[model samples]
Target chain A: MVKEQAHTVSSYEQELDQVRGMLVRMGGIVESQMAMAMAAIVDRDEDAAMEASERDPQVDELEREVETLSIRLLALRAPMAGDLREIVAAMKISGDLERIGDCAASIARRTLRLDAGDARLSPGGLRTMGRLVQENLRRAIDAMSQQDSERAVEVWQSDAAVDELYTAMFRELVTYMMEDPRTIRSCTHLLFIAKNLERIGDHATNIAERVYFAATGEQLPVVRPRGLPVV
Target chain B: MVKEQAHTVSSYEQELDQVRGMLVRMGGIVESQMAMAMAAIVDRDEDAAMEASERDPQVDELEREVETLSIRLLALRAPMAGDLREIVAAMKISGDLERIGDCAASIARRTLRLDAGDARLSPGGLRTMGRLVQENLRRAIDAMSQQDSERAVEVWQSDAAVDELYTAMFRELVTYMMEDPRTIRSCTHLLFIAKNLERIGDHATNIAERVYFAATGEQLPVVRPRGLPVV
Candidate 1:
């Protein structure tokens, strides 16, 4: 009976490891989607945007799979404490990653619209801001995959850089609108794109915080940069 | 043994009920805060904004309490299936509500930044958009409190109206900036306030969806309006 119980425990652990692997795979797709969306925007590549948009459903499918697997592990394995937290955290991190995919797809859609000349206004600072936010998201996922709380702490710390970029981006966009009437349409789309990237960054920070909680069982301080208000 | 088990089951039910009550209460405060923030914006009343900002900590404290109670219930009850979903939904819904409170506080801060001179800019559909979004949020909480999936569906249906109003408001604000450069800063703040309220509406919709899932074990369509890009 003891040997049987040990075998059952080993099987549960294997299931958990499989779920973790799926999460990492989903994270990779999400990261690629963001990068492709960025490229689509910067290069005004509609085909790339369409490809990113099409790939969103695949990410969605993976998210659903991860959720089902996590719940099954909970019900079947009855994992305790740390194991339970890991499963639950996996569920939440997948959720955040799924939303990140949504943001990337949304950015792709905006890129398509911009390419169609719905808005051609280019307010400065957005490309840099997008790059910064995308990097933060990528690092946050890496931190999760590595189970490195220290790397997660760095992601948490880097949230301020994203916010700083967003604030400066906002200021620049508003200034452009104030100065050039013709730039309003394009600038508005750019603003929405910037906002989407910033929200993606926020979700990444949320995942990092969850990682810290999963590792240490304590919530970390979520510090916003100076001058920007937390929403 | 049966009698002791009955007593323990009743105690668990009571605890669950208590947590649900606190969540409803927190939702109420957040809804009220959203309304008051809009009122402050429309009336340009700094005092109302200040009051909304101050009430945030109360909501935060309630959230912390709910989190503790939820974790305790999960540990003690080891609830399965529908019961577990309800508890988990409550935790997630409370989190979204807490974020709504934070957004309201953010709107209040933006209001505080706008001096008497800043209030001279034409708000241009912001008041109507704010009202629509706040109504959606209120109905969402009401649906959760009553466990009415039909009402939750209604809340989901109204998301398009909020989005429509947001689009109209965005267009009006852009037109204002085009007509007059002096309105840029005030209008930018107004834009932030509107965007925050719109996001709160989205979070409220998220909670309503969770409530629907908890009660019916089904995922519902997130019906966004047609003609708007799905950002």
Candidate 2:
């Protein structure tokens, strides 16, 4: 009986590991989607944009798989507080990751539209913003994999930089649109892409929070760093 | 023994009902927040904006309570297929609603910014967009309360209208800003508010999907209606 009980505990641990693995995998897909989407804009590659848009279904499928596995474990294992938090975090993080994929797809689609327009304006700080969000996303996923709250906190604190970069991009794009009505169509699309990237940064912070909560069994304080100050 | 079994079942049912009630309650708070935030923009009332921003903490508290209660039920009850879906749906819905509340608070902050600028542009279809989103949100909550998938489907289909309205408003605002550079600051804030409203519509659709999934064991068709087109 003791051996059987030990086997059961190990199975539960296996299930928990599976859920974590799925989340990290989903995060990887999201990161790739963002990178590809940004590449579409930077290189003006419509094919790359189309590829990024197509990749979203893969992210969505992974989210569904993660959710089903997490729910199955909840129903079957009846996890205690620590494992329970991790399972719940898996669900929440996958949801955020799915949204990030959507944002990437949106960016990709906007890039296609920008390419169709004749205004060949510089992307202006957008590449830098994309790099920052991508790094934050990577760190958040790394923290999740290692169960490192400190690493998660670092990713959480870095959202301000992404937001500041986004605000600057917003202003720059608006000026470009104002200077020449011809650029309005393409700049509007760029504006959406910038907003989407900002939102991806927010999602990274969200995943970091989930990691912190799962590891420490406590939510981080409500006082967080702010990038976009109220005007 | 039979009496004890009956009592346990009733208690589980009571817990399920409690989670649903909390979600609807949270939904109500979100709706009120959106309305007040829109009113702040419409009436140029900084007080209303501030009030909406302050109310967000209450929404956050309710979300925490709902999550705690749902997780406790999952751990203690180990619910089977139908009840498991409901519990999972409750968690997902609460997350979406909390985000909607955050979006409303963001709108409120942007409204305050707009008011401070003294440019005082006409809100320009923002009120109509607010009404559409509020109605969609109300229907989603009602569907959850009644377990009505048909109503959820209706809400799901209505998102396209919201997207079209948002696109129109985006163009109008851009034109206004281009016509007079002085209006740029206030118009930018309005643009954010409009985007926030569009996102709330998306959240309502997400909740509707959850309601449908909870009512039917099968997931909805992945080919769903979308409001914001790729472009």
Candidate 3:
């Protein structure tokens, strides 16, 4: 009887680990999606853009898998305390990661439209913003997989920088449109693309918060650092 | 023994009903947030914008309550099948509704910024778009509380219409910015506000999907209607 009880507990632990592994794997796919989207813009590679778009379905499929597994664990295992928090965090994090993929796909598609416009304008501060957001996403995913609350806090704090950079990009893009109305079509797409990247940063920070809460069993800080958005 | 079992089941049912009630209550707060946000734009009422912004904390508190109650249900009750699905959907729906509140607050904040600028351009088709979005939100909350899958499907189908209106507004706003450089500041804020409303419509549709799935143990249509996004 004791042996049977040991076997059941072991399997439950394995199931919990499996859920975490799936979330980490999903995060990796979403990271590549972000990388491909960024490459699409920096290199103006239409193939990269298409690749990023293609990755979206895969990310979404993984999210559903996480949802299914987490629900099954909830209904079957009846996790308690820390395990319960982690399982709940898995559901919320998967949702955020899925949104991050959507933002990547949206950015990638806009790049294709911008390429078709024949404007070929310089990206200016957009490159800086993209790199910062991409890095934040990486750190957030790292924090999740490593279960490092401190790293999650770091990622959460970096959102302010991304927001500030986005505001700067907004100003620069608007100036481009004002200087030459012919560039409005292209700059407009860039505006949304920049906004999409900023959104990705926000999602990453959301993931970071979930990670921190799940790992530490406490909320981050009362007052999150916020930047003055241009819009 | 049977008497005690009956009592336990009755209280568990009450817990499930409470989670659903919290979600519906949260939805009502979000709908008003959207309404006040629209009023801020239509009547240029700064106080309405402030009210919309203020309501966000209340909405958020309700969402956290839903989350706590749902998590407690999962950990304690270990709901099966339909009840489990409803609990999961409650958590997801509350997240969406909280985001809807965020979008409303963001829109309200931007209205203040728009008013700060001297350019008081006509709203064009934005008024129509806001009304449609508001109506959809109302329908979505009704579907949730009533467990009406058909109403949920209706809200899901209306997303394409909202998206189309948004694209039209995007073009109109760009024209205003192009025609008069002085209007760029105001129009840019308007652009983000329109996007925010479009997002509120999206959150409502997401809630609809959840409500439909929870009520009927089935996913919505695989191919969701999508519009050609201006970005």
Could you tell me the lDDT of residue B72 within candidate 3? 82
If you superpose only chain B onto the true chain B, what TM-score does each candidate give? 0.94, 0.94, 0.96
Sort candidate 1 into its docking category. acceptable
Q: Which residue pairs clash in candidate 2?
A: none
Our tally of clashes for model 1 stands at 1
Q: Which residue ranges in model 1 land beyond 4 Å of their true spot?
A: A115-124, A222-231, B114-124, B222-227
What would the DockQ be for model 1? 0.44
Which residue runs of candidate 3 sit more than 4 Å off their true CA positions?
A115-122, A229-231, B1-7, B115-122, B229-231
- What is the docking quality class of candidate 2? acceptable
Q: Model 2: runs farther than 4 Å from truth?
A: A1-11, A115-124, B1-14, B115-124, B227-231
- State how far residue B181 of model 2 sits from its true place (Å): 4.0
Among these predictions, the greatest DockQ belongs to 3
Better of 1 and 3 by lDDT: 3
lDDT to native, each model:
0.79, 0.85, 0.86
Score residue A231 of candidate 2 by CA lDDT.
28
Highest lDDT: which candidate?
A: 3
User: Model 1 chain B, poorest ten-residue lDDT window?
Assistant: B221-230
Q: Tens digits of per-residue lDDT for model 1 on B139-169?
A: 8988898888999888877777777677777
Chain A (alone) TM-scores for all candidate structures: 0.92, 0.95, 0.96
lDDT of 3 at B55: 88
Candidate 2's residue-wise lDDT over B3-81, tens digit each?
9999999998999898888988898889889888888878877888888888888888888888889888987888888
